[model samples]
Target chain A: MPRHAPIELEKFVPYQLSIVSNTVSEDIAREYRERFDLGTTEWRVMAVLARYDGDGLSARAVARLTAMDKVAISRALARLVANGRVLRRTHRGDKRRSVLRLSAEGWRIHDVVAPLARQHERAFLERLDADEQRALARILDKLLATDAAVR
Target chain B: MPRHAPIELEKFVPYQLSIVSNTVSEDIAREYRERFDLGTTEWRVMAVLARYDGDGLSARAVARLTAMDKVAISRALARLVANGRVLRRTHRGDKRRSVLRLSAEGWRIHDVVAPLARQHERAFLERLDADEQRALARILDKLLATDAAVR
Candidate 1:
């Protein structure tokens, strides 16, 4: 019988990345859900809008920037719009199209949530020494750039 | 007016981690979906079962091992069982509860998929030098351990 070596899920880089990302994301998502009744996708859209501020992004632009599925982004946008967290307006540049931005309420949430998100990131980074933190950031950049090149 | 700095999404650690993880996972998932018609959760459950091999794991055990939602795990198990890729038998230690293991077909799929998964990991790691690779692994361990401690 040929010996098949089992892949150790714990040591698997991709699996580890997934778990770590999911954990961090879930923790942040929990805060958003509990405090603001925002789902993961919705909060992500809000975050992008918060970043863009006055320069509203099209749904297509949001999808591209976030690298999220179009359908998921659309759904999140709908929920946000319905709940009055996001405002959709006709694009001034293109009358045929629309763009999305956070409402005053949305900015209020983003102002609070963005800082909280930063706090969580700081807490996570504090576990590592300065060297490890630098390495992690550099490694992620390389990996992300490489992945982006392929896509 | 006090200016609130907009988080540079591109530089944000958590957002970068998420985008990288999602890209890698989505790429791998595309392969699995195309080749084996497997969902991410299903492949994850299969990987866990393949690791255990003969000693089957209960659904709850699989959930714990994967750190996945119980509902998602259950749904994946159902799909696997329905597709005849996994076998569910009453636990030997406790007759009331059931345990899951890969069937012969499941093992066949695992044998093929495991190597493919390793290939993807290797390809991703090839972008980094030896030091970067080692640093990434160590950094992930630290981050994962710290995150785990909180939960």
Candidate 2:
């Protein structure tokens, strides 16, 4: 009987991707967590809100955009709302639905943290040369699109 | 005043990597979670142990190999030990540390699940062409190496 080859975790693409993603995430999370006391889900919520600054977004929309779990997003939103970092207002078009936006304080933090986040990304990408960076971007896009189509 | 550009989450590399990683992870998690009642960390621990069959590893070693948090690894180890899927034994050379390995039942499950895990990985990678796969492998390697050097 031919024995099956054992998986080398280091060589496994999914495992490698998870490690790389988590490392990048944890580094960024540390930056905001230390200064702003924000968790990963909370910062993600704030980021989406900051991008749609004026229009705001519903909790569902935020969850969709971030690709985060609804329960995690809900908990993050509740904490942000409670802490005055986010403002929740009834949607103009739908009375039952509400939209969330960064409060002035949230925007202030976003402005500071957004640049730091971008800087972190730039530093990480700098490890790869121009050609490698482009390849990574294209590969990620292809993988994401394929996964979406599969689902 | 010139306005600063907000991060387009869809275009951001880290954000994109995160979404892709999480989607892949969640899909695989669903498979094992339903069939084996395994959480992500538990499965990760099991995978590492399975890879190093016969030679048990310390929890610290598992954490380092898996790049998971020590606390999370500890919790998973506790649960696996309690469930009899893993056996904890005293180290031959170092009495202070206990080494962990999969039990007979653990190997039984690993044999079934590892192939499924590899299949999922292969299906995901098949989405990209051969060139794209090579490029992704190189890029991920560079990123992981860079991260290791930085830390």
- TM-score of the A chain in candidate 1: the value is 0.92
lDDT (Cα, 0-100) at B111 in candidate 2: 82
The per-model lDDT (C-alpha) reads 0.87, 0.87
lDDT of model 2 at position B25:
80
Please state every model's RMSD to the true fold in angstroms. 2.3, 2.3
Residues A30-147 of candidate 2 have per-residue lDDT tens digits of 9999999999889888888877776779888899988887899989989999999999999987997678988888888888888899999998899999999889989888877877
Model 1 chain A poorest ten-residue lDDT run: A1-10
- Could you give the DockQ of candidate 1? 0.72
The CAPRI category of model 1 is medium
RMSD of 1: 2.3
What is candidate 1's lDDT per residue for B1-151, written digit by digit as tens?
A: 4455566778888889988888777778899899999999999899999887767889998898888889999899999999999999998768877788899999899998989999988988889999999999999988888778877
lDDT, residue A75, candidate 1: 97
